[model samples]
Target chain A: MHIDAIQTPAVLIDMDRAEANLAMAQDLANDLGLGLRPHVKTHKLPGLARRQVALGAVGVTCQKLGEAEAMADGGLADIFLPYNILGAAKLDRLAALHGRVRLSVTADSAETVAGYAARFGPEAPLTVLVECDTGMGRCGVQSPEAALSLARQIDAAEGLHFGGLMTYPPLGHGPETNDWLTRAKALLEDAGLASEVISTGGTPDLLRAGQIPVATEYRPGTYVYSDRMQVAWGHGTLQDCAMTVLATVVSRPTPDRAVLDAGSKALAADTCGAPGFGHLPAYPDAVVTGLSEEHGVVDLSACTRKPEIGERLRIVPNHACVVSNLFDRVHLMRGDEVEEIAQVTSRGALT
Target chain B: MHIDAIQTPAVLIDMDRAEANLAMAQDLANDLGLGLRPHVKTHKLPGLARRQVALGAVGVTCQKLGEAEAMADGGLADIFLPYNILGAAKLDRLAALHGRVRLSVTADSAETVAGYAARFGPEAPLTVLVECDTGMGRCGVQSPEAALSLARQIDAAEGLHFGGLMTYPPLGHGPETNDWLTRAKALLEDAGLASEVISTGGTPDLLRAGQIPVATEYRPGTYVYSDRMQVAWGHGTLQDCAMTVLATVVSRPTPDRAVLDAGSKALAADTCGAPGFGHLPAYPDAVVTGLSEEHGVVDLSACTRKPEIGERLRIVPNHACVVSNLFDRVHLMRGDEVEEIAQVTSRGALT
Candidate 1:
């Protein structure tokens, strides 16, 4: 099938561009001598996860247990969930998943660690990594001492093994993140805790993974489908973006305005500190000014040529990860030909 | 099932509140002597749409044909899709849907009218409303004259009927919108084109529907499930909100910081000119500072009390309509008791 054969307001993944992106990220990890565990949250497809594993990835990282379960169901053996798992329901699910595959999780607080310790037994231990707040300040232990405390707590738990550390560092703060992780690793080492896996992630600073020498693994989610956000941060160019929203011009209401069928529902409401909602590669000067639920209003005044009614245009969204989560399936295209239509297996896995 | 038994990061629709919201809107429309056409884009549930119809709503409004198709499959007889339907694939779907239900659509351009004219036949004529731009400036004919011109074009078409005029008017511009629609209706009358239905819609100015006396039908999507946006626009109070995201406090990294499992994927990244992504009734002063894919970072310094790890929080999202589209299933609740878990049939019906 050709690209035009598909419906409007659809997510199209350029297969060639996606494969090249995967290969480039894998080569970077190999050159940096770091284990590459691509986060499946970007694609949320089992086939894409398998492709990453086949490309020499150590494992796959899932932000939610539902996503991890989806990956495991797709035959992914080694999976790491770098999230604080709480509550009896999720813990029960975690125990079941651990029984199926090699599982690892992270914790920033003792409350989360206690829940994990209660679920698993020493006979079947679960690797628990202490999440360190290097500089992101989202979800992690406050300081190096706090990281040591969590490591000690994980070591003391009967069913838990103290796996090194994990951090989703702030963008462009490579040196600061590296320093923080180094000090935390040294503190853990001084306390006789061997840091086995120091996993760090951020797509913007993915190429600078070598700066964090202490990080044994690099997990980059958006690098597989670089978006306008990655391009804005100088990670890659528009050509590197594999995913684009295929939308049709439903109404050219004004001479300067053209509305597409894609809106916040299709493109998402995420802004990467950019000027507009999305970038139209065909009309680079045209700005997607605003988005309703099902209408993307484009300001075509800046362009020399404006799209007419019924014209199809592909839009590069600001964020790739969130956009993937919005759709149920994606059309994988090889240039202009449709390769496959894959279900986003973990699309609404928000448990 | 009890609300406590359910997992966190879930969409909970308070059935009592939802029913009350539905009744209030219907009563208001009845009192104002206008045909109520509730937009199902808010709830996206067939059962809820049925409730709206049972409460004397003339029909349900949909923004996309996919939504109308889902509603039709769910046994909804009347649906008004106020969007420009283009392309052969969509027109084919629209024609099929028209065969099943009482369908009416809007078009702003002759190109769209031509597409409809090619598909439909006079034996089963399709109702095509001239979409007028009443200052919203999104997808509609610019002037009242343009609306009449489009109406004349629809009248001339072999398979289409110029049923009426439709406008998604600009918020808080009731007088200007009324003037635009009134002039357009007069133009249609002067041209011997009878506008059977003068439809106008906006959740913020729904109460002022009576102000547009020329409008025979009123469509309001968000009034069925009032959100923070509606509250910000002074449409309803926080207590009037029906849909909320039940999220868990997964990490309380600092005394002033609390991270939730519900982020953009669960709560959405839409802001209604408000300060934060959501409003936590439990902690009114707390602000949701930022959101990652699965992490909602909350700043709790302003609150007198803070949420601990594993504590569940019911958050009213910024926009209810988009939030409902994010989840696959919603737990309908009646004061802490789970009533039912219904599938959002049109959750990803973006086409």
Candidate 2:
């Protein structure tokens, strides 16, 4: 099968580009002497995760247990889920997963750690990372004091091992964020508690991971498939992008407007600081001005030669991770030739 | 199975509310004396489509050939795809579906009609509707002249039947929209061209669907599961919403911040005119301030009672259609009791 033979509105992964990206990211981590634990949440394909591990990643990081489960089924051994696991149902699943793989998770509060404690016992201990809020106000404990409190709680728990500290820092706040993590590690040392790992991640800050100094391991998801947002953030150029949504021009209603088969359902509605939903390689100036569920409305006003009906184009979405979740299977491409088809093993694994 | 036993971050459909909403929409269409053709892109469940058809819909409207195929497999005889059918791959699928069911589609240009004419023949004629731009600046022909031209092309085509006209009008543009459709129909009549159907749709304007006297059919998808946007648009109240994302509060990082297990992956990031991502039923005062792939951060500063870790809450998302597409199966609930689980058979059918 050739790349052009594959249906439109399908995810096309440039295998050569992805291999280069994986090697580049791994080499960057190796040069920095930081443990590379590439997040599998970006591609969600076990085949890609295996490639990442083969390229010298210590393990794979998963945001959801279902993703870890998929990876484990695909023969992955070590997994780190840096999200709070709550409820008896989820905890039971977590406990079962801990028995299967070398698993660790993160918690920002005593309540979450307690939930983890109730599930895993001393016989099957689970490593727990204390998520700290360096600057990203999304998740994690607010301050160094709160981090210590959570770390102490994890240490005291019977079935849990206090793995280390983790933070998804705000971009460009590396120095101060490192200072904050350093203070928390110092406080842990003062209390005679050992911090095993210091994890930090963000594709935008993957190159600067070594600058933090305190972070022993780095988890970067989007680095495998740099997207429009990555280019917009100056992480990499558009040529570095591996995954593209293969779409066909479904309608050319006017000289200024051309509609594509890939819409919000295919490309996703995530506009992570991009001017539009996605960037078209064939028509660089055409803006993806609007998207309904199944229609991506492209504004071809700026383009001198507008796309016609049935003209296939590749779109690099704003956020690659979200776009991967929107599809079930992705076409692996080597140049214009089709390499293989890979299942998005953890596409809807949101449990 | 009870509702609480179901895992977190699942799509839950309130059966009673859904039934009520379905009946209300059907009754409204009946009262309006307009043909009801509910769009199946909202739920993408065969059971729900069957229910909608049983309620009095002339047929089902689909946005994708994949969706229409799913509906056809579910025993739906009449399926109208109001999206421009482009490319030979999609045309082959459309033609195969036409042989099995009474399939109709929309075309906004001559190229799309030509594709249809090449795939299908008079024996297996496909009903083609000229998609007109009723002021929604999306995928539609810009003017009444354009609509007439497209309709004339469909009529001239050997394999296609000029079905009628269709428009996804801008909300509340009934008078002028009717004037435009009426003028186009009059031109078709003057040219001895017959338009058997004139369809218009928008959940926000479903109540005023009859106001457009030229429209012979009304297609509304979100009415079955009205969302936060529906409430914001004054189409319905919060209680009328049938679909709710059952999410568990996984993290309470601060007194004011609580993170739910559902994020953009579950609730989706498609905020359709709502202030935040969704509406929390348990804590109406709380705001869904942030969303990552697997984490929905809530702001509880305005609330007196903060959500604790492990507490499950129901969130009504801003848009129901996109949320439904995010999940694999939707749990049917009967007043806090799990009734059944319906597969989203057409969820990712975006071809």
Q: Could you list the chain B TM-scores for each candidate?
A: 0.99, 0.98
What is the Å distance of residue A61 in model 2 from its true position? 0.4
Which candidate achieves the best TM-score against the true structure?
Answer: 1
For this target, which candidate reaches the highest lDDT against the unseen true structure?
A: 1
The residue-level lDDT of candidate 1 at B253 comes to 91
Question: DockQ score of candidate 2?
Answer: 0.73
Model 2, span B120-151: residue lDDT tens: 88876789999998888877888888888888
* Candidate 1 segments whose C-alpha is farther than 4 A from its true place: none
Query: In angstroms, how far off is B112's CA in candidate 1?
Result: 0.5
State how far residue B81 of model 2 sits from its true place (Å): 0.9
Give the Å shift of residue A192 in candidate 2. 1.3
Q: lDDT for model 2, please.
A: 0.88
